[model samples]
Target chain A: MEVLFTFLPKTAHQEKLEKEFPDVDFHFTYKEKSRLPSVDILVTYGEDITEEDISKAEKLKWIMVASAGVEKMPLQAMKERGIAVSNVKGIHKTPMAESVLAHLLALKRSLPFIYESQQNNQWNRKTGSSELFGSTALILGPGAIGSEIGRLLQAFGVRTIGCNRSGSAADYMDEMTSFEDILMKLPEADLIISVVPSTKETKHMLKKEHFEAMKKDAIFMNFGRGDLVEDQILLEALENGAVGYAVLDVFEQEPLPPEHPYWSMKNVVISPHASSHSKKYVDRALDIFIPNLHKWLSEDLNPTNLVNLEKGY
Target chain B: MEVLFTFLPKTAHQEKLEKEFPDVDFHFTYKEKSRLPSVDILVTYGEDITEEDISKAEKLKWIMVASAGVEKMPLQAMKERGIAVSNVKGIHKTPMAESVLAHLLALKRSLPFIYESQQNNQWNRKTGSSELFGSTALILGPGAIGSEIGRLLQAFGVRTIGCNRSGSAADYMDEMTSFEDILMKLPEADLIISVVPSTKETKHMLKKEHFEAMKKDAIFMNFGRGDLVEDQILLEALENGAVGYAVLDVFEQEPLPPEHPYWSMKNVVISPHASSHSKKYVDRALDIFIPNLHKWLSEDLNPTNLVNLEKGY
Candidate 1:
């Protein structure tokens, strides 16, 4: 099998793959698009693959995505070409969940203000703080990352509610509701975290109306796709004091423009799309790919994380 | 029964106490030390009672301190007078533990740096982050707060080691050691939190030698007493880059002087002794005090958190 890794694998990672699967031609180079010509397997991390590369790869049988979301990839073309797609799903649960808790805790503890006080050489004991215990949290996705966040929050005695498309039973939800029923839950959540994927059904899921429903002191965090939340509406809500604090790790635009008010908002934490970027990232990505590689070699090509191209997630 | 509330109880808190205990005369005043003259039951939060006040209180039988630490109070005088003392112990567990986690996670994830970048309108994704999963933490004073912090970090898969004076078993600690054996464990800790009391033996416990033994990139936090850690020694370590980050919630000299070098250190987070100040402070303190009130009235007069004068904690 001829494989091309679009993600620049670390030397150890590349060596491990090469050593484990000696029969496979593992061509791991991020810059060389020419290697895509005769590749049978391509691994990427939601990178936008060129149509030219897709057309040239007549021998391509599978595409492995090294991310939970596969929305940015050419899903339609890949589907038309009969390419089996498997993504590194559910692997971001630990890092993403940790990031959410970290940011939320920082806001409640007045940590940013405390740091500012430190900078000013002021001993500020007046800044009031609240604990995670007895707080209500609403998780918009409730999939791998959301459920894991809920579980972690539960350890702190936070009551967790989850919203899902089908209102199905979710692992760590104290209560589950349909997406349509989520707006009412907005007023109930002390914390509102949206980890919903980017799709037609979820596009602009959280706007002014949804933000308005949340408690004035509610902390909102978006570690999901930027398309799921309207930035302008969120900004207005923040300005109007309808939302207390917003930790935006994902934005409508990458490397959010300098003109954006979010950068200047004292109540907002602009995390530069690195919430899931951990030192152990390469190892986590491999946990998904290596296991599936074994299954693929045995002709059981349908991996556990096989993506449904029509769903666009 | 006569009572003097020196902590300035909120009207609501005063009303609740008065409503619950009709027989007790609640002398609620933060100022006017004249109120202490006829007090039989004194309610305070580690405020020192002068020799004059002690001599004036002819009927003073019990002092209810609304904090875990009673070091500032006249312990020797109270002991000599055969006056009973009670403190609200273990009430700070939740808030203190949460504060420790908040600061540690912020350092590991570069939340402070990210907030700085947001202020500068810079999109910097290169500020690397380390995950808590594979890290190890060493907690000093493995009492209620220490154990609670250990349990919470366990959910994040952090290996927790605890140090206690007696080398006694503590909950949620993967390993427990004595104060003497702590030096060896210093180099292994990614995070070191000190919650040890400000006792004679514990004063300057974490000095230059301890800081030198710690991992170069280790994050150190002092949420215990200021006296337990030597400020000058810590400043030297921070300057020398021996300590990666220092979250000092307590200082030897509070309102830590404007000219203090800690104010100028980028690697330090001057926490201003507010780590345990939560909005729910009144309610949590009452959790310990109210029950003791009932016990005192029944003539049993035995409080769960009665302080041993010699220990000074």
Candidate 2:
């Protein structure tokens, strides 16, 4: 069997894989296009997978993404090829939540203002600093990542209201509500965080009506798919003071076009979609890969966390 | 009863107090010096309390300082006059802990670098990012504030070692050790946070030797007393790569001076001695004040969190 791994290979990991499947020809390079026809498995973190590679790979039975989202993959081609797919989802639960908190605390504590003061060699105590202690947070898409975020916030004494498709209670949330009721529940939260994924139904789910329904001083944060929010509506909300602050980790476009208004906005906090980027990412990714690899080898057990292509999740 | 308050009066709180103690004369201004002579009780957050004022308040039986530190107060006079002195010590636990987490997450996720990129209107994804998960944190002074910080860090899957005088295990710490063992244990930590107070033994507790003992890539944060750390030694560590990053909220000299190298250092993050700051400070202050007021009115038990003039804690 020929296995093609797209990420940089670690010595220990390569040795471990070789020891497990002694007869397998393991190739760890993205540029090995000539070997595509004989490749039995394709492992990727979304840099080199393309429709052409998928078409050329006649023996490819499995394609694994080492990140949560498989949106970067040529899903249509893989789906038609009857290729099994799985993504590393649960690993990013804590790191992304931690990243959300990093910005939320900075915004509340005015750490950026403090940084500006430090640049001028001044020691200034920024007044009117807020606390998460008594504030209420509305968490959209209360799945793994969102629930983890709520759990962390719960430690800070913030009341978390989980919003999902079903109005079912989650472990860390103080209460639960349906996503359909988001606008009605909007004004109640002092902090709003959305972790909704990108889908046909979820794209552009939160916009002008929802932002306008929020409290004037409410903080809006999106660590979810950028498509879940409308960029123009968010910009208008910030300018109109409907949203007190917006901490955006993902954008409708990557690199944010260099001249976007969000880059220079006073009330905006921007990060280059690196929230889930952790040194431990590869190790955690391996945890998913090893398990699913065994399942694929057995050929009888269905792979866990396999992406449902028709549902487009 | 005559009560002299040195803080500006909030109308709602004043009304609530007056409604309960109708016969008591409450003078809520520092400039009301004529009433100082007859002040039976003094409430201050440290602007109006002076040795001369203490001498004039012959009838002052109780003096409540609405802050954590009593180093600025005339302890000798208060102890000599047989007046009860209390300072709000435990209220800053959550806010300071929050502040510590803010910087800890920021450092681990490269928030300072993100801010610089944002300043240039750039969207560069910083690689080789770190996480608090599976990291070891050594917390100095595991009392009210330090323990709270440990609890929050524990939620992020960090192994926290608590340091105290007795070396007894604290609630949130995975292990406990004495302050004497800090040097030996220093090399084990990826993160070191100090919440130790300004005391005779604690003054200049951390210096060049301690920073040199730490892991080369370790992050050093101080939300403790400025005197506990030697700033010159800290600067040397940062300059020589002995310390990977230094987030200092307090300094030996603050408004941290215009000429200090820390203000210009690339590896430094500074906040102006405002770790304990929060918009709910007054409400938390009232939590201490109201309790002490009732205790005084009852005239039975001594006020809680009293400052020991002799031991100076």
Candidate 3:
């Protein structure tokens, strides 16, 4: 069985993958390259691959995406070709969840102001700082990353509520609600974390109306996708005090424009899209892929983290 | 039956106490003033309570301190008078632990640079960021706050080691060791968190030699008293790359001088000792203290969180 490694910035991560899978016959190529007829498994990074890449690999049975979001991939083509798609879902959970908690704690503890004071060597003890314990956290996505965040928040004794497509119960979550029902529960959340994948149903999910439902001092954290939230509406929410602070790690544009107003906003924390980019990220991705590769080859078993091309999970 | 509030800034907290303990006779006064003869319990805030105040309170059997640190109080004087002392220990755990995690995540994920770029409205993608999972964390104090931090770290799958006087086993802590043994283990820690109380033995515990033992790119966090670490030694470590970065919330002196090098160091994240100063802190402290007070009065039970006068815990 042949395995094809198709990813962008392939040269950067190729050495690491070569070292881990010395025994496997791996073909390292750009996502745009013509696929060989014998290719059975394809691994991709980013959105460099096209529909033609999927159609050419006649024997391709599996396509693994090295990212949490699979929205940009040619999902319909893969599904029609009987190619199973799996994603690097839970791998981003720790770093993403850590980022969410970092902003939440920073906002409540006022670390930015404290850091500024330290910059000026001032020992001003500003009042009105708050703790996370006994506060409510509303997680918009109850997937691997969102659930992991809830578990972390549980240790701090915060009430956790989750909003998902189905509105089903999640471990460590106090309550679950559907996407349409999020407005009803918005006032209960002191902090709202958006980790939902980008899709038709979720695109622009956090619009002006959702912000209107939030509490006065509510903090909004987005580590999922930039397109999932309407930035203009979010800014309006911040301006009106409907949103206390917005901690963003992803934006619609890769290099946010210099003239953007978010740069000067004190209430917003704009982080480059690097929340899930960690040192061990590649190793972690390999940790999952290698085992699944062996399982697919030997037992013809489907991977556990298979992503539905139609549903866009 | 009678309670005396003996703190200079007791008026604000005293009002809440009065409402909670309406049945008990409450007398509010500064520590320099004579305590009411009928007082059985004395509550104080600051370090320096006059000797005259202690001698005058002949009926005082129990003393409660509002702060976490009991170092400034005359422990020997209270011990000689057979007075029981209890403090609001672990009340600072939520905010402090959250702060430590905030800085650790920020340093690992490079939040400072991201925030700066956000200020410039530049959305740059940075590589080489590290994750907390599979990392090793060494907590100096394995008391309530430290153990609470341990629970938070467990969800991230980090290896947690602790150093305390007793070296007792704690949940979520992989191993416990004495302060003297910390040097030998420092090399293994990716993150070193100082949560130890400021005491004679612990003062300046993280000196030049200790910093030299840490691994390269290792992160240092000080949510404990600033006196526990030697400032000059820490600066040298940061400069020499022995300690990659530091997230300090407390300092030896309040309002660190503007000329201090810490303010300008890119490797350091200086916070003005506001980690535990959250808005809900008072309510949380009261929640713990009120229940303990009820136990003390109704059940004829001594508070479980009693402090050891000699140990200064």
Residue A214 lDDT in candidate 1: 92
Worst 10-residue lDDT window for candidate 1 chain B reads B45-54
Candidate 2 wrong stretches, greater than 4 Å: A10-16, B31-34
The candidate, 1 or 3, that scores higher on lDDT is: 1
Model 3 chain A: worst 10 consecutive residues (lDDT sum): A7-16
lDDT tens digits by residue: candidate 1, B31-85: 5668776888888876657667778888889988888888877777788888998
Model 3, range B1-313, lDDT digits (tens) per residue? 8877665433666778778888988776665445456788877764756566678878888888877888777778788998888888878887777777767766666666676666566667773577777889999888888987887787778899999877778777998888878888899999899888889988987778889899887988888888998788888999999988888878887677778888888888777777778766666666777887888889565886798988888
Best by lDDT: 1
Q: Each candidate's root-mean-square deviation in Å?
A: 1.7, 1.9, 3.6
TM-score order, best first, reads 1, 2, 3
Q: After superposition, how far is residue B245 of candidate 3 from its true place, in Å?
A: 2.3
Candidate 3 off by > 4 Å: A1-41, A52-62, A80-82, A252-254, A295-304, B1-15, B20-42, B48-62, B78-84, B288-304
Please tell me which model should have the higher DockQ, number 2 or number 3: 2
Each candidate's lDDT (Cα)? 0.86, 0.85, 0.79
* Chain B only, TM-score of each candidate: 0.97, 0.95, 0.88
lDDT of 2 at B206: 81
Which digits, one per residue and each the tens of the lDDT, describe model 2 over residues B213-251? 999989988888889877778888999999798888888
Best by TM-score: 1
Summarize candidate 1's per-residue lDDT along A247-271 as a digit string, tens digits.
8999999879989988787788899
